[model samples]
Target: MPSTPGAGQSVPGTAVPGPGPAWFGAVMGTGGLSTLLQLHADAVPGFATGAVVMLVLGWVMLIGLGSGFARSVARDPQEWSRSVRDATMVPLWGMVSMGLLAVGSATFVVTEARAPSLASVAFGVDAALWGAGTVLGLATALGFAVWLISRRPAHPLPTWALPMVPPMVSATAGGVIARQVKSEAIRSILVGACVVCFVVALVLGVAVIVLAYHHAWFRTPVPVALSTTTWIPLGIIGQSAAAAQVLSGPSLAGLARVYSAVVLVAGAGLGAYAVFVTVRGFVARMPFNTGWWAMAYPLSTCGLGSYFLGWQWASLLTVAVLIAIWLLCAVASVRAIAAPRHA
Candidate 1:
């Protein structure tokens, strides 16, 4: 029930309280890193150990979210809704969905038991969580979109891409789950659902990114605290590409290849820009806060995208990009963990 400083309040050298959604970045970061490591488990030694660490980190963030929400509600019942309406904070809902997806993915990757019952149980649990998270994520995205359209807030930030990104997370997670299903009919249905989710996220995320760009160009530089959010659009691209790769069917195979190729280039470009902006902000002594977690999921997804493309095209450059992204995510996650905590 402890409260933290809101975003936009932190100054260099000052200890700042964290925001409710701050832990969300940890969820995204750990979850995304876990997924990336899971994908490259063959090449990477100790993949299980790395996944376990991320799973534990994800659980901690989940607990933090529960506690943070409880505290926020206790302080003001209306605060959560108000935050959802806030352009910068609305993306926390996507964190909730992505966090569930991350943990579920880690479970599938690390649980090595071959017994039918155990595998069934694990898949069942993962599927249930994915269903719930997807529902919540979609609802949050839709509700926020309606509110945004009606309210038409000025100076929108790239953080607006947050709510839209969750369904894509669900799509990626669902695609993973779909691969395990025995029924072709069921698998096809699941794959189709993932495709729909991908489209929704892509369309909405791009719109938000465009608005954020206009705001930044015409209005002002984005607040330093939110510099990390510029990477979110890359997350959308990366995650969608990952989902398409997983859900590639006879119908989607060609589209998936094209999607992966395009996103690889786009992700690399956006990632470079994000890195430059983030480094500049850090050099300017941007205060450490939960917002730094924003770097986690995006970088992780870009890595995922690169890995997918590498496999599809047998491209060494994409493989190298994946490695570099993994390292960068690791560094960012460690720094986020070591950041000053709110009392």
Candidate 2:
């Protein structure tokens, strides 16, 4: 029997006070959309305006939600640790990092035409933020990995892939910066670092994906709130492909091309599977939650990867894939923003 609300008790539809780290998902989703718009600004009319709006919104959410999250964690240390250990929440660190990267990408696009110096400053700031985020992200990923090994939680969800995805975010952002920066030495360092970051994230992420798939296959179904996480592996593959292409210098160009092709094909296959899974889950009336924001960044990154490969190969298919990705991302963003009142 369902329990009824008692006197003075919070009812099902009541607004809850305080904020959670999941709020960072807004920053991640909006920022990612902003970056995608910036990337395609030349092709899409009014993309600049859209990117700026989304970028500003992302920053607002970051500042507001970040402040609330910090306060909540400060007030409840044990709860903070528990969240850190949670497979779903652990990815908030990556979302924060990706938000910084998205802001940087938008800054670059918006300012490069009128204020080159400001764009450079923004790039520097982005690099600094990426550095800090990468360190924190890696530490958190390691901690979660250790906990998983020791605690051996049952029926781990695909969201476990969350903790391992951040370094790839670093790789993508760093690779972009490296390609644009003036100094050759700095470019080489950035490229090398991004390559290493990509490798680390790919290896670890693959392990997590395998485990999550095993659990989903043999154990229990994924919780509705986390259905969107099925796309995370696509994000990992897509980011890796993009980063590899950017970091592909003359010496490694051949290798990079091969790797990019492999990952692109892999990502496309997985994206198809994710689309089916997501549709079925949504049809089942998956309740709105912060996890819905999971739909944005992964799809954006996958689109980027498709663009990279298609451009390199001079294929018309890239245009079609990118258009589909853009539409999906738009839908996902709208859904995330209009999510239910319940946390």
Candidate 3:
């Protein structure tokens, strides 16, 4: 099993790798942009338009990639199985579920802003996506952990956290939908589900994160190809914080919020270091792989988590940073289209 992701993928020129892990990250990031915009649209009306545009674009990419993967698999039936065995690629499969959750949440947020009357419809979309995403997310988190443990694993890297993140995404997104639904019975079930996923993701995710830390601290610097994935850990921190805060039901809400606050503040210290490392990476001209999309969705979670904490100023700063990341990704995409690269 390879330690590195191997190839940058022909994101524009090929179909199979076009649906690569980071490709889905683009969908996640775009949908995440919509969530950020909807959160602040009331304070700055200009964000509303971008919110809707991003919402639509996110959905388009999601559906487009879904179809692309379908066609690719139909043409080469072994592709899915191949990806599953590819150590460098398998962990990143969590992006599939993350993309679904991102788009689902964005759908709810945009509808809440522009079409209140359509909340029911939005709920349907959100709930369906949540269900699908949760199943896939659980599978990725649990299945990958088993796969890693059952075998002699390669050295740990930040990307190891990728497969662990979807449930955290699920926990946060599930909390949002749980509050939206009116049925007490369903709400109770959803909150329980959210809590279960939160704990599952948190325990396993943290262990992997700590081991990854030990690897970076005691071993070698993370290779340039996977450097962007340093931001990936933010997804776990931010989503877990956001999930804890958003969890409802009298029995869960208060305690969850308290836990959320503590993690949110502590995560900020590491978040700052992640940002510094990312900046220093620029001196080496960080390459634009799909992994760079980490700046989009995972980083946005930092802002989303802050907003849930009612830290508007902190959320705004995170948003400003993500906007720049978005532009850089756009430029990178255009450049990649013009000239594709391989490992």
lDDT of 3: 0.79
Q: List model 3 lDDT by residue over 117-189, tens digit each.
A: 9988998999999999999889888888886688746677777788888998999999898887789999889
lDDT of 1 by residue, 1-343 (tens): 0012223223434553343554566666766666566566666577646766766776787777768777977888787776665544555666777777766776665553323456667677778879988987888778778877988877677777777888888888899898898999999899888888888888888888889778776888766656666777777887887887887877978888898888777677777877777787778776555566666676666666667656533333333444454456457445654664422
Give the TM-score ranking, best first. 3, 1, 2
Q: List clashing residue pairs in candidate 1.
A: 5-17
Q: Against the unseen true structure, what C-alpha lDDT does each candidate score? A: 0.68, 0.65, 0.79
**Top-scoring candidate (TM-score):** 3
TM-score of each: 0.82, 0.81, 0.91
- Lowest lDDT sum, 10 consecutive residues, model 3, at 7-16
TM-score of 1: 0.82
Pairs clashing within candidate 2: none
Window of ten residues with lowest summed lDDT in model 1: 1-10
Q: Is 2 or 3 the stronger prediction by lDDT?
A: 3
Q: What TM-score quantifies how close candidate 3 is to the native fold?
A: 0.91
* Model 2 accuracy (lDDT, Cα): 0.65
Comparing 2 and 3 by TM-score, which wins?
3
